[model samples]
Target: MTTTKALLIGQRRRLALTMVGGFAGVVALALAVAVVADLADIRTATALTDRLVPLLVFYAPAPIAAAGAYARCGGPACLTVGVVPALVFATLVVAGTVFGVPGVGGGDAPLGGVTMSFALVGLSGAFVGYCAGVTAALLADLAGFGGDGGDGGDGETDAAE
Candidate 1:
């Protein structure tokens, strides 16, 4: 009986999926920031990075991460959903800004001074998405949407058996 219950994901699994998505988004955003930073000429790269990296990071990755989590984890959600993204964001910040990866991550000094603007933004977005997904899933279950009704979406009916 492949019912809605079967389709429903556990809280732990949903959280895991959310974290995975968030990590993927954060990593992609970090790479983009680095690439963008390196796009400018030596004379203007620092200025461009200082102005652009933060915006790109703020606008791009957070949504991607949140969407991934929301789509996969339609459950009550968990702490990991937020923690993973935050950790990933913090790691990237430390690596890109603190380690001073020359020619990337904004480098040292005025070059790499933009990531801090939205360090928590990505995590917060993922958390919100996860929460929404959880609420949606719960409401669906409450509405009896999870029941098999002897007819799963796959077209297989209990009458056939």
Candidate 2:
């Protein structure tokens, strides 16, 4: 396959995997935290879990997707892909804070506090997920998992040549 095609595929796959894995990790972490703390009440844990799970998931793929896109498109696109999400997240957090949206981990808190917490959690999760994804994508690229290095004796390559 062409390098572009390979990169697109890799990016998409990496994004999907990163999202899934990150979400799963968040849920697992929340569960572990709840179990350890003996705060198994759904009301208490649910808010925290809800706030955290998506954030965990969102950031998980940022790096990987960026790397894959970079491998496919080169520096500018890679940088854009890597940076846009972070910018958006930051913007949202700022807006939410200015508007007094409660989004932090403390769902039991007031609306503004909760909004801030949620925003913080979501942004944090996305960042983390993105980092994980980028690292993984970079590693994969280094390992020659993505991109068209050369045809591996495929009949298509022979025909094209």
Candidate of highest TM-score: 1
Candidate 2 RMSD computed on C-alpha atoms after optimal superposition onto the true structure? 9.9
Residues 1-161, candidate 2: write the lDDT tens digits.
45444433332333444544454454455544543334445676676766664544345335544443444333233323333333344444465567665452223445555445544544454445444545554667679874355442222232334
Candidates' C-alpha lDDT: 0.47, 0.45
- Candidate 2 Cα deviation (angstroms), residue 19: 6.2
lDDT digits (tens) for residues 1-161 of candidate 1: 33333234332343446456655575556555555556544547656565655554444444443443333332323323434434454565467566675543434544223333344565566556555554554466578863334443334343434
Using lDDT as the measure, which candidate wins?
1
Evaluate model 1: give its lDDT.
0.47
